[model samples]
Target: LLEDVKTVNIGNEMAVTLSAGIGMDGLSYAQNFEFARNAIDLALGRGGDQAVVKTSASITYYGGKSQQMEKNTRVKARVKAHALEEIITGKDDVIVMGHRIGDVDSFGACVGIYRITKALEHPCHIVLNDVTTSTKPLVELFQDNDHYEKDLILSSQEALDKVSDNTVVVVVDVNKPSITECPELLHKAKTVVVFDHHRSGTEVIENATLSYVEPYASSTCEMVSEILQYIGEHVKIHPEEANAMYAGIMIDTNNFMQKTGVRTFEAAAFLRRNGADMTVIRKLFRENANEYKAKADAVSQAEIYRGAYAISVCSGEGLPSPTILGAQAANELLNIRGVKASFICTEYQNQIFVSARSIDEVNVQVIMEKLGGGGPLNIAGCQMEDVTGTEAIAIIKKTLDTMIEEGDL
Candidate 1:
């Protein structure tokens, strides 16, 4: 169909071109339409002017060579925010959850969800797991606050046991079904609403009753913050919760220096007016001496490549958890002159973790996905089993080389 469409020239100066998406083997017509819609999005996301086909088992792409145009998203966000409120009001209970081993962005978004549900007078619980050192300070702050009801934070097992037909699970920050705090809970819940700012991966929660994912936002908190505005003027965010969301936008945007945009600052301003404390947010970012030293050590091991990229492998016996250090190290490497993309690979918890950060010119998510992980274009990470940090770095380098050769970098 695309070839036939392209064969015609509407005018001497204008040639006709078409992009098509095909979907098949779906159990229902709705599922088939969704697959076709996603396939077309993939075709356009990879730079349009092509045809893409989606099946139950595979996705095939062809003839994409043009650049994609940037879209205006504010209107779309408002529409989804309104739709989300309707879904929440209809549900009996709302359970909020983020990715496992949550980060500030994840926790911040979760807090935002909790606040939204509270305003709606719905029963809400935040499904939490063991957090990394990076989230400890803020988590402790929330735990100490009287307003942050401790019992509302439950374990994955507890959340799963509470799930019922009328329960709505709100997954934030991360959208991949497998990485959510409780994939089982997500599967068990009758209604699911997802709010995420990360690039959608292949293994996403396709069955969400309401899905609000905007990859261009600075963080999931940024997306949530915007949604908060549409919930109701009477709805309010406590200082602690506002602070958490602010910290989320700060960390994800590298303190408004990385992917910060108009909406990012708008959300930050709204939080500030609602009593978000900048001083507290600054305190939340302060790392202990030991963790700071570890981050510095990771940065010290960095090696620059491809003139604009940096890679660091932190390997030693009994080092601190690599999850936080790797992320901090990746962020730190970006501060170095001439580095547009940075990758930090470290071994922790019997697995190799890779954190990748980059400017818009480089889509680190694509690179991370190549290593069996996914995230936004600017930030991404993956965990590798049975691989040393050195081995992971080698694999990253090989992937980078391939991307360069294919003009994908």
Candidate 2:
């Protein structure tokens, strides 16, 4: 039904799409209505153009093949920014956090939020547990520095202990609570806020005072940069802070080549005008010898499955951040001709991490969702436990075959 509805053309150059939600097994009509409301929100959050069915047991999705249209207006950003300012001003303090296994984008968004809270004259601390090799260089700039507080960054336990009733917990880069740097802080704080760019999933931070999640945005840093402008005219962005946010946009968009839009460039320009130095960010992201070799090996060993999917595995034995290498390898595999999508797997911390990427031919998010993961349509990932790399490949192949047979790919 959804596919048929999606086929309805309004004019010669355009077509209409529909999103729906169905609820079942509810005790009462009101309960079912609430369920349906949540389901519809999930459908739209996952980029619309789909149907979502929610029962007591599970949630199912259908017909989410189309890309989400970007909003040209900045009205939503302005409203969200005002709301965030109000929340921060009312709070006594703020605690900022991002997803686990911190990446450059995640930490950069944290820095942006930190700047916002400080400009509002509220105390703020960033909760970061593990800093990956890619983010260490950027993080070192603020660690133990005279310009920032000594307690600027804290561990999960310290953040949990410091969170108070009047403190506002701002989660950036990720919306899911399970993968956040500190989930316990959510329960400890009375107020919560979320700012992210990834498409939403079934799991999300509940009861957020402010939730600004834009799937069309290039990165969370881009979203935060826009919000920073609306916070106040006097809000200043230091060079290091601007560089951090700019690096995030650069990393997520693959250096402005992928997922680049007018707003994306505009956000980059905003950071640039505020003293973002591309040369410094480039130096911060320089690859070491081991990382370079590992990425090259993964690409050289890639297998083009069905002449459209490229699959490979990276042996990141000596690399400080194996998952980062795997993700980079997935991006590199897209250079191969006739490869519509790519998947690079790496064994890290007793789990198999699969990084999926594509240009436009495939919806990698759906593919990763099948394996209990979610991300944007072009870039996604999944983690598998107790599975060998070879077995993981076989499972992915079977999944591809099934999706192909069902006309889903």
Candidate 3:
């Protein structure tokens, strides 16, 4: 099939290319489907325009050296949303969780899920703990709201203690098992569901009852908002919840400057109709003087490479939180005229945390994946133990140089 696609030539001498994944020797249909999915991902990762066949014990590949076609559609998202509704409705307890250092996108999606579970008349709990600095303001707002129930928020250990045979864990904003706030609770849960906008990582949660990973969506909250549209009109979303989701979309889209699509706007409009106040969201984004100064120092310390890549390290004291500071620094560096991609390295929690961003040309996802991290093409991150900020920057530079030389960036 790939060869036939390659053989077809238009009058102007343009040829088409296709990639195929063939699954055979499977004991069941579901097993075969899983094999095909993994095979296709592998084929695309090796650079598409190829055919990959995966059996129970062996794998074979042919012809891969072309760019993979990008799929942008909402049909699959709708289907997955319905499937997730079914999974949530059938379960007794729904526990929602996000990655470590929960951000706006993560917490917003959790609130969305909590609303959904409540609408379905199922008991739900949001597993949360310490948040990054940027999320602190939003979390405080939620806590202060009359409609928000602090009792519904559980710590990792608390959630673990309540896990039952019928409990279903819904992981949002991230699907990677290694990055979740509590992988142990996830393991103990009877079922798992994932909704994320990030690219799939190597350490994915296995056998999720429903997995919705949309790399094209601006944020997980955007995907959750779209799901809400399909979940029936009677479903109620509070003003606070709506605002949280809206704030999430705004943060991930960089205030509508990055990765904004038609669907992204549609979600925002829905939130606006639900009383997502922009004034409150602006207040949530307001940074204190010290945080602003820390961000400025990070920008001043940035090192530009090849006139396109900007790398910065937060070396000094007084930075409020390394994770939030690194992300802020990365965003700040992108404002530079010639920089196409930016990376902010910081020391946090005894690890070197690197937050990376791009203007969609550098494919930061692939770059971060090499270092055991993953996200979308424009934003990605990784954390490394036993490495100083300077050493981590050097490793990143070396990796970038190799990818650039190989024409992979």
Specify the highest-lDDT model's number: 2
Over 249-363, each residue of candidate 2 has an lDDT whose tens digit, in order, gives 9999998878878889999999999999989988889998879988999999999999999999999786778998899899989988899999999999899999999998899
Better of 1 and 3 by TM-score: 1
* lDDT (Cα, tens digit) per residue for candidate 1, span 184-215: 98768889898887765667787788887766
Please report, in order, the local distance difference test score of every candidate based on alpha carbons. Answer: 0.80, 0.91, 0.82
Query: Which segments of candidate 3 are over 4 A away from where they belong?
Result: 1-37, 41-73
Candidate 1's displacement at residue 260, Å, is: 1.3
Q: Kindly list the per-residue Cα lDDT of model 3 for residues 57-87, writing each as its tens digit.
A: 8776555434234445668777987887888
Stretches of candidate 1 above 4 Å error? 1-36, 43-53, 60-73, 315-321
- RMSD values for the candidates in order, in angstroms, are 4.4, 1.1, 4.3
Error of 1 at 57 (Å): 2.5
The number of clashing residue pairs in each candidate reads: 0, 0, 0
Off by over 4 Å in 2: none
